[model samples]
Target: MHLQVRIDIQRRRQFIQIATFGVLLIVHQHHTGQADPDDHRLRVFYPRRPKAHRITEHMDRHLIVVSDVIEPEVEHVLSAGLSAFNDQMTGINDRQSLAVTVRNPDTHQVLGGITGRTSLGLLFLDLFYLPESLRGSGLGSRLLNAYEEEGRRRGCRSAVLYTLSFQAPQFYEKHGWQRFGEVPCDPPGTSRVFMSKAL
Candidate 1:
């Protein structure tokens, strides 16, 4: 009879232990579920993009508009200063700085501006800035062709430039430039796309 009582106690203790474990598991699951009602953290997908050879793009020319704060000032200043400095080095102080300005043929008002440069025997069609309304017009194409002609005259073998992933990659591709490398941007998930074409 004592043996039977001890067996009963042991079975009862096992049952209590199992029940306690089940209750704890239920409470843990309930708390976890309550903490995140909308489970958005569990879903992510990474797609593979084409990889290409890495190239450190070197730029030698630029354009600047100091008065226009709405524009990219530092880029303009850097480009202008570099061009001026390079010209001074070559003993050619003439206004070789090419700033392509488009005007409305009817109103005679300036539409936009584009800048070009020659670096290390290569003409670089670096900076092209046009207002929104002027886009889709043939002005960009005209400016590019003119810039290439200038580059040819300057004896540059190639032209290179960079654009952000959010910007006009398709446009550059359409214009016979090929993508070479991309640098991932920090703090934001973006990339700088570099492209070049033989002149």
Candidate 2:
């Protein structure tokens, strides 16, 4: 029982740390983009928890590593931790996998499709891909529509996604998705466009 309590407390601290970091990054980004310091006001979300102390203590016990390759084990750990915290915070632990796959009719091999999830009344589109030969054949739109329809069936009220500037922004716009923000990224003049739609 004592160990469980300790684990719960640690998860809460980690949640607070992650939330605070996001708030700080937004504030810093806004401030940095402005030509004058006073042009934008810096707002902070101060959690009741001892954020500095808790973060320091937590960081001291953990090993931080940077890598270029995909690590499924690391992803699982982070996802599990965040899911627990989200469940505790909102009291809604409904995270359903949403996907629309394109498979070879002959071999039943999955080629490309859309992958996403719906949680807390929101649908998140994480990735979407289709072969070059399949583009402009109306299959992409069909797959996207199917994904969104399933999200609605799963009780999601809104959907969010990010696409590269050179990618399918116009396609999404034509299908009722609106741009909310854009952040410049690599390859020069390219950016990641964040979009959303009300289901």
Candidate 3:
């Protein structure tokens, strides 16, 4: 009888330990917004459902604005969505980006730079910036030329970029880039000009 009692106690202890572990696991999942491995659906945990619903309703009613903060994960999701759409539309996904920087030789401080991607036989200049001190000093031209040369080496035939009306449209034109399109934008009279050049 004692042996049988001891066996029953052991079974009860094991069951309790497993039950406690299961509860803890569920609690952890609830707190961390982690879903079960078998569940492929995305999950987000909120402390209160009412608040979450209010926020969702606000987003549905208004233009979502998250003040000036850069959310890298959100950006990654957006980029991934576009890339997936592009891949679906075109079987060729040969897009590759390159960044070029100019720095002070002595201080190694970055002075100016350009970044863009090459795809579909074209180089898309996404971002280009040179300090006011370096503008019109021939450094901008050298940097632009070097980037185009690199793009040519990478099999890009044409290059395209955009600049605001108040920005470097004339600078790009002076570098042999031809204005191809203009998009009217905010603040009324201003526009964004698209330019391109054969590499």
The TM-score that candidate 3 achieves is: 0.61
Runs in model 1 deviating more than 4 A are 1-96, 106-108
Clashing pairs for model 3 are: none
My TM-score estimates for the predictions, one after another, are 0.49, 0.66, 0.61
Backbone clashes in model 2, listed as residue pairs: none
Determine the C-alpha RMSD for candidate 3 after optimal superposition of all C-alphas.
Answer: 13.1
Question: Per-residue CA lDDT of candidate 1, range 16-86, in tens?
Answer: 11122232110011123343333322211122111221112322322221232434766799879987887
- The CA lDDT of each predicted structure is 0.60, 0.74, 0.70
Sort the predicted structures by lDDT, highest score first. 2, 3, 1
* lDDT (10s digit) by residue, model 3, range 134-190: 887798888888999989998999999988999889888888899999999998999
Which lDDT value does model 1 have at 45? 16
The TM-score that candidate 1 achieves is 0.49
Clash count of each predicted structure: 1, 0, 0
Best by TM-score: 2
- Looking at model 3, residue 34 earns an lDDT score of 57
Residues 30-144 of candidate 2 have per-residue lDDT tens digits of 2233344333222333322232232222353463333455579878998999999999999988898887999999998998999989999999999999999999899999999
Candidates 1 and 2 compared by lDDT, better number: 2
* Regions of model 3 farther than 4 Å from truth: 1-70, 186-188
